[model samples]
Target chain A: MKKNFKLYISLFLTTLKISAFTFGGGFVIVSLMRKEFVQKRKWLTEQEMLNYTALAQSSPGAVAINTSILVGHHIGGFLGSIVTVLAAALPPLVIISIISLFYNLIRENLIVSYILMGMQAGVAAVLCDVIMGLSASVWRESKTFALAVMILTFLSLALLSINIIFVIVACAVAGVIYFGKIGKKGLKNDLS
Target chain B: MIYLELFWAFFQIGLFSIGGGYAALPLIQQQIVNNYGWLTVSEFADLIIIAESTPGPIALNAATFVGTRVAGFAGAVIATIGFIAPSAVIIALLLFLYNRYKNLKYVNDALRGLRPAVVGFIAAAALTILKLTFFSESAATVGLVNIASLIIFTLALIALRKFKIKPIMVLIGSGILGLVIYGGLSLI
Candidate 1:
């Protein structure tokens, strides 16, 4: 732990730079971080990365922050988590604050507005990719019933304008039931 | 009064919206457009447009824009802070717990289950965003044949997938088209 202090600092800095440069949120940043941490530094295995990502997601923090903390703690103990999460979070937090302040005037300007509109279209495209990407993943991993739940959730909230809380509650119940069934079957199979 | 309510509403949005920026959109849209009437759906649409193109996360950008629209500078700060507060507080708490447990099996299992669920949630949110973008209610308000935007979108996707053109380029190029086309159309 102590020997790799320089390596950890470098990793922290690299993650920070990537976070600052990437304009999008967690998913894009996650990809960038994975490239740096996994492919470049050989710090974490792909399986480790996936495990950390899952932990980061379920935990209460921003996925980006959570991931940084996980990597930080894994490498350098408590202090490492602090340093990395700040490094990851600080860039976006500062940039967003500035953007938030001037955004109105920017929104009103014609050239800026048009550019924004174009970006809006681009956002939609990016989201389309996200949908396509996740669509395949969901189909592959999720049980068919679970996929049905997901599709229904999407249609209800996204398309028909149903209340989101209702959607969340419905999904939570479905998840609990699905897991309950799986847990019971696993236990039964073991008994046999 | 209304703006204050809007402020608190967005604060709640920021608080509850977990997973990522996209997750917050449906709730934010509901509160602002349908419930509070702080913005029209088209204005909200425009906000989404502006939010994506600019720097930072979309949810925070929405908070800033909607906050400003509802009130002023102060409103913007309040809303921005409000949106971030929940996650910030939650993160702080998680950091505290993480130090103690470090590694736990059930914690790991729950997280594994959660990953797929989050994928579901994000996919659902993405679908909602697409509807907000393309399948709009009133077609007249959108520019001349949104298919142009759609084409640009499709081309940009292909560029990203096949050619490996960076998203920033797509963003800038499409923005230029928006400027030229909308600017040109406004004149005519």
Candidate 2:
């Protein structure tokens, strides 16, 4: 019981600490999470951690949320997933709640609005960087066919205004077919 | 009534938004802005800024903010839970079976196909935000260039790429720049 209690506390506190500065974004938290779980606690091997990162990226919801759940389950069990989920979800809930309390006060302020507007522009550029990085990595990893999939996805979303869910599903289906048949050179580059 | 809707809406967001947080932005924009009318176009953009700057996942922050705006404390609670439900549930299920099927070659190929598309989706979302920020609402609209915002955007991008600044720092810097340029000058 005492060991279980200790494990739970570690799960909760570690996730809380890791998520505390998720300020940069969800993906950024991976490094901090690595430090805590892999380096410090020694819970996960490097390969395990990499697998978790890949799975977290592919899974639904936020990367942080999926990661914490995976790590929690890795350490504990079903109950561990719950604890990790709560741990991952708690800090943001608290912070946003505090901000929400002041939402009216800040929303009414002209300066905050201006700052947010400016930040929106900044956000756009940052997003552009994210896109460039994503495309470059994708190109390096898989080459032309992957680039074709990306372009088609972009065209439908940007020009056709198709629903994003539909776009994603269609792409997944395409992935299954294209890679299933074109298994010549591409098979060596598969992530699994 | 709104609570039920909030739960359903965010649940869909949590379920369908594959890839990760940034990829999720487009779906959240569609639901919150176009479908529900929870926030205006500009307000939704600000939501991204606030969500990006705050600690935690952007999706969690967004659900909490929009929930609180629409329904208050209860709203926040349900929305956040709704947002996290799928990841926990589906991932739990996957964890159970992952050991067996993790090595399947077909699975690898399918995921390979999905990667570029995920990148594409993220790029599209970024472009959508860029259009909203740079131009007016649509292409036909004239001269709503938001020049001051453009300046911050350019500077922040430079600070990020050239200076190797942290994103939080960029956001804080943009906020200050916003205040100095817009507030001190009384532009608005």
Candidate 3:
């Protein structure tokens, strides 16, 4: 347990540092996470990492936290998860806490504003690239249907202010229906 | 008990937040601004700005920012812990059961359908961000400079995709571009 605790602490710190420095949100963090968990430590297999990502994306909170907790738990169990969560949360919590104290002082600065605007542009670009890249992956698996849904959904939300939760819930329901239909087809095929 | 409630509230947010942190923004806004009345919309907006500018996940950053706002340092800790608790629990449970269900065919088919929806959700999020950033009808007229900014953003994006450059570097380059434009405008 003691040795496991130390490993958890190390993993937590690794995650914290990665989370702290990697900007442009969750996608950048995914690469950093792969480096740490997959390339360096080999704590998780590629399939496990992909599975964790899927679970993390669906489950909520921050993908960062969910990924950390999931990865940590996989490597070291319950205590590992606890330590990883702390590690993942602490750096940002501490940094943001300090920023909250001095946010007003920084708010009106021209240079800071310029930097943020730049970062925002960069963030927007990165997000677009991610969407495009991920779209190809989606297309590969299911061809035109997934691509069409993706583009359509993007247009709907981009043009109109439709609530996102409605989109996700609809998709999840669609998944259930597709599977149910497939199952019925399979059973009939088996009998026939 | 207050802390527990705070934890639980954030936990629920964490649990239901698909498409990562940004998707949770509306939910957080609803909970903090509408339901709890913990912070004003403007305050929440300010926190979001800071959260975005800072180097962390927006959700955790918001949790910390709003937590501190609500209950100081302890509140920040409570909120952070609350936000992460559910995912940790759920992940562990999933890991334990993953092998048992790994080869199930219906499960695979369901995942296939769900993958497209996830794509839809992400695309939806990207659209929301674009709308938020670009199309503010309340601003009356779009300025020439803003249009220039958009063009520059597009070029920067093309460069990014072509070169596979990191976003931070592009951000710094854009920051320099902004300085040159705005500072030149002031001189003119």
Candidate 4:
């Protein structure tokens, strides 16, 4: 009982700390979470972190909290997942609530506006970095095919201004058609 | 009635907000600003800044902010739950089905295509924010590009990419740079 409680506390606290301190976005918190769980505690392997991060990204909802739930489950079962999620979510809930209360006082301040403006620009660059990393991974698999899809997707969203929902659905359908033929069995053969 | 609309709107956004927080921006902009008129376009842009700088997911922060605006505390609670429900359900399903179904070609293929498309969305989101940050509404008529914002952008990009700084550090550094540039200039 004591050991189980200890595990739960650590899981909760660690998630809380990462969620509270880390800023920018889900992807940024991800690296910190991996360092703590996979590197420091050895609760999960490197491959598992990579797998869950990818899962979190591709799955719906908040990637940071989703990942905490994933790793928490991997560690402490369903109960662990619940604990970790609450821990991950609580800090933000509280922080934003405070900000909401002070919204008017802060919103019109010239200094606050300037800082926010600066942060937005910085965030744009961060998002661009993520794009480069994501594209590189996609390109490494099937260069020409992935490149074509990425270019098409970017242009549609950026220039044509297509609805995001349609863009995602069309890409998913294309994935099913194109990749349905090339299963791992065939992929294995190709590698050899 | 507004609460019900808030619930449904956020629930849909949460369900569809794939590719992480940035992709959620366009959806939130559409629903909250364009669809319901809860916040003006400029207000939505400021909300994005708040959402990004604050902890947690952008969607969660958004749900809370919009909910509070529409219906106070209860609205915040309902909207947050609505936003989280699909994600919780989906993640739980993925967790359970993950090992058994991971290698299926359709699964792999769907992800393969979805992956790049998601990146494209993130890129689009960045461009959108870039426009929001740098271009003023008056720019259409006056063409007043904020030079201070341009300087901050270049400095921030250099700090992030060249020096390999952490994001929080970059944020703080930008704040200081903002105070120095914009604060000083406004006084002039």
Which one wins on lDDT? Answer: 2
Clashes of 2: 0
What would the per-residue lDDT of candidate 3 be over residues B1-188, giving only the tens digit for each residue? 76776787787777656567555665676567666888775456455556656788887888888888778889888888787777667666666666677543543554565565555555554444454445422112175235434654686688789988766576667667656655565566
At residue B54, what lDDT does model 1 achieve? 52
Q: Write the per-residue lDDT of candidate 1 for residues B1-188, one digit (tens) a residue.
A: 75567567866775555566566666777778888888876577666665555555666667767776667656766776566556556555655665578654444444434434445556655554555555532222355346556655677688767776666677777778767766776777
Q: Which digits, one per residue and each the tens of the lDDT, describe model 4 over residues B16-119?
A: 88777776877787678768999886677667767767778888888888888788878887888788778888888776678878744555577777777777
DockQ of 2: 0.68
User: What are the TM-scores, per candidate, against the unseen true structure?
Assistant: 0.71, 0.90, 0.76, 0.84
lDDT of 1 at B154: 75
Per-residue alpha-carbon lDDT of candidate 2 for residues B1-188, written as tens digits (9 for 90 to 100)? 99999999899999887777687887888889889999887777778787877888888999998998899878999999999888778776666667768854554666777778877777777887787877743222247776776778899889887887877788888888877877766644
Off by over 4 Å in 3: A1-12, A24-58, A147-163, A179-192, B1-9, B19-55, B69-71, B103-114, B118-145
| lDDT scores in order | 0.65, 0.81, 0.68, 0.79
**Candidate 1 — what's its lDDT?**
0.65
Candidate 3 CA-lDDT value: 0.68
The alpha-carbon lDDT assigned to residue A133 of candidate 3 equals 77
In candidate 2, which residue pairs get closer than 3 Å at backbone N, Cα or C atoms, i.e. clash?
none
Ranking of all candidate structures by their DockQ, best first = 2, 4, 3, 1
Please write out the lDDT profile of model 1 over residues A108-183, one tens digit for every residue.
Answer: 8977866666566776676666556656775676668546765676677656777766666556566666766777
Per-candidate iRMSD: 3.6, 1.8, 3.6, 2.3
lDDT of 4 by residue, A51-167 (tens): 998778767788897898799999999999899888987776777777777887897887787676667666666666667778899899867778888889889977998877788
Per-model chain A TM: 0.74, 0.87, 0.69, 0.75
- Our tally of clashes for model 4 stands at 0
lDDT for predicted candidate 2 compared with the true structure: 0.81
